[model samples]
Target: MCPRSFTSTSELLSPEPALVEPNAGNSHSLRANRLLQHAIPPPMLPVVDLDPEQVRVLGCLVEKQLTTPQQYPLTLNALVSACNQSSNRDPVVSFSEEAVERAVTGAKARGLARFVHPSHGRSALRYRHELAEVLGLDERQLALLGVLMLRGPQTPGELRSRTERMARLDGLGEVEAELSALAGREEPLVRRLPRSPGQKEDRYAHCLGSAIRHVEDSAPDEVRQRDVPSQSPVPAPSSPAPGAWSEELAELRHEVARLRRDLDELRSQLGA
Candidate 1:
C-alpha cells in the first residue's frame, strides 16, 4: 500500500503512533495489541524513505534554513550550490539544478519539503524542508540530522565539529545526549552502528534514508579510494609529519575563503 501524502502542515504534525508491548502470557492483551497495530497504520505516518539525492536536498534545506535564516527558503541555484559544497559534506557531489529540483519534488510528495512559486517581486522559486515541524525536532536535533544526511555515519566528535555552524553542540556529552534522544523516539530517527575496527567510538546514521546502508556496503571501496593511490601499489600513506600540517591547514584556509566568497554572493542575490 502506498503511504498517504501529507495534505497540510497540521497533517504532517500528527502525533506519533503509540506502541505498547503486550505483557507476556496475557492472551487477551496480546490480542488487543495485534488489533491496535492493525488499527494504527504505518502508511498514514509522515515517515518517508528518501533516496540519496532526496536526502541531500532535504539536508541542504535544513542546513541553510538554520545557518542562514535570512536566506531561508533557498532558490534553486543556491540550493544546488549548497548540495555541491566542498566542506561539511562527504562524497561531495556535483548536482545540477534539475537534479536538485527533482529531489525537492520527491521530498514534497512525501511531505518533507515545500516549494514556493515566485511571489512578491521574487522571480525564482524557493525550497524549504518541513522536517523540524513534522518531526518535532529542535535546531540541535535537526542540525545533527542534517550532518548525518549530508555526510555518512559519524561519531559524536565529528557531529559536534560539523554541526557547529548550524547549531551549538557544546561537547561530546551534549552531542551524545541529543543523539540518544533521537534514537529513543517512537520512530527512531538515528541508530548507532557497531563500532568499526580501529575506531573507538560508535558512529550514528540517519534512519530516514537508505543511503547510509549503501555507504556501509561500500565501505571497503571508500577505504580503498582514500588509502590507495591509483598509479602506485604502495600501502596506504602514513600520517603526514607535523611539519606537513601547515600546508594542509593553508589549503583549508584557502577553501574556506572561497566558500565565504560564494556565500557572500548568494546572500547578495537573496537580498539578505
Candidate 2:
C-alpha cells in the first residue's frame, strides 16, 4: 500500500478562487446614496387670516373706492366723506377717526397694509388691504351694500338712482341684475323685500348683523376679539396750534392768493 502513491502536476495545483463580480442591483451602497438625497421636507404655503374688525374696515375702504372712483384708492378725507355719506343716522359699526387710525396701525403691523400720517398729506399716505378679495365683494357691491345698510331698505330702482349720483352705472337693468344675483346666492348678507302694489320694482335690505354672524362662525377662535364699547364717543380734535389758523381758513387764503396771481398774470398777458 505504500508503493501506490503517484504525483500529477494538475492534481497538485490549488484551484483558482471563484470570481465575485460586484452586485449590479440591490446594493447597500446605492441605497444609502438614495436616502441622503431625500433628507429634508419641503416648506408649506403661507396662510393669511383676518379678524372681524379688520374685515369690516376693509369693506368700508372698498365701499369708499366704489362710491368715489375718482377719489379712490381713498385718502383719509375721502374716507371720511364716504363714511359720512353712507348714512345720515348714526352707524352701527361707526369708525371714528381714532378707530380708523388704530385699525390702520393694526393692519400694517400684520403685514396687510401700509399708511402714512395725515401730516404728510393724503398723497403721502396710502392704505391697502391684502385680503380684500376674501370679503367676497367688488367695490361696486360694497358701496351698494353700504348705502342700503345705512338707509335701511331700498328698491333696486332707488339704489340705481342713488348710486348713479356718486358712481357711473351702465343702466338700471344692470343694477337689477346685480341685485338679483346677490339675492340668488343665498347669502346671509342680503335680504329681499316684498314688492308693493303700484311699484313693479323689488327692494332689498343689507343684513349686516347676519353677515357678522356668518363671519364669526366661519372664523377661527384666535381672530375674534371682544365687542367694541357701544357708547364710546368719537374724541374731539384739540384746539389748533397757537397763532395757527384753522385748516379751512388756511385753505381759503391759499385759494385767494392763487386766484390773485392768476388774475395778475392774465392782466399782464392782455397788456391791461
Candidate 3:
C-alpha cells in the first residue's frame, strides 16, 4: 500500500513576477538585468566544441584581455603565454605549438583575427581580435592591424618591423605587398591613418564598428592598461618556454623511426 499525497497547483505554477514600485532605488534585480543586457557572450566558434586545444587558445585570448585590457588586441605570442600561465595547470590545459597554430588557424578561418605579416621578415605573425566578430586574416595582415591599433599609425616600413619579429619572415617586401592588396580591395579591411610629424611611412587602422565597442566594454581593466604603443613586438612566449618546434620535431622523428623498423621487420618476414 502507498501513502496518500497532497499537491498544490500553486507550487507547480510559475511564481508571480516581482512587483516594481514607481521609483525603486538601485534594486539588485534591476542591476542584474542591466548587466545581462550589456554582457557580450564569448565567441561561438565551432572549434571551441570540437578541439579542446582550440578552446584553450580562445581562453588565452580572453585571459590576456582580462589581464591587460588597455593593452588589448594582444599579439599572438602574448595570447599563448597567458594560456600557459593560467592557474589551471592540468596537463589537458597546456598549449603546444601545434595546438596553438591549429587553434589560431582555425580561429582565423572562422574570421576571428586580422593578421599582419611578420615585422622583420620572420615567419612569426601578429594579430588583433578587438572585434568580437572573427575576420579572416593572414599573419602579415594581422600584425599590421596590431601595430596600427597600439601605435596609432605608422608607415609600411615601421609596420613591417613591428610584425617582422614574430612573422619569422626575411624581408619587408611581403608587408608592402600585403598593404597594397588591402588598399586595392573593394571594401578595404584596413584604412590608412592620417599622417603624423616626421612620419614618412604610411599607416593604417582597423575599421571602427559596434563590435569594437562591445569588446571594449566587456574587457577587464588590466587588459586596457598594457595596450599602449611600444617600440617593438613584445618578447616571445615567456612562460611556455619557446621551444615547441624541437618537441614536435622529436615526436615526428620518433614516429618515422618506428615506421622504418616496422617496414624492415615486415620485409624480413616476407623473405622467410
Q: lDDT of all predictions, in order shown?
A: 0.83, 0.53, 0.51
TM-score (all chains, Cα) for each model: 0.63, 0.41, 0.30
lDDT of 3 by residue, 1-272 (tens): 11111122222132423444434676776777656645634322121121445445544454344445665555666766755763432233457666677776765554444465666545667655422333334555555654444343357776666655435435667777877775555445455654443556655544422232122333345444456545686788656445887888889999999999999999999995
* Top-TM-score structure, candidate number: 1
Estimate, for each residue in 72-133, the C-alpha lDDT of model 1 and write its tens digit: 89999999999999988887999998899899998886678888888988898899898886
Model 2: which residue pairs collide? none
Candidate 1: stretches off by over 4 Å: 1-45, 213-272
Clashes of each: 0, 0, 48
Candidate 2 global lDDT: 0.53
Best-fitting candidate, scored by lDDT: 1
Give the worst 10-residue stretch by lDDT in candidate 2: 1-10
Residues 146-232, candidate 2: write the lDDT tens digits: 556455467877887777644555788877766765555443345576554456876676554444334223223322332333577
- Where does candidate 3 stray beyond 4 Å? 1-134, 208-272
The weakest ten consecutive residues by lDDT in model 3 span 1-10
Candidate order by lDDT, decreasing, is 1, 2, 3
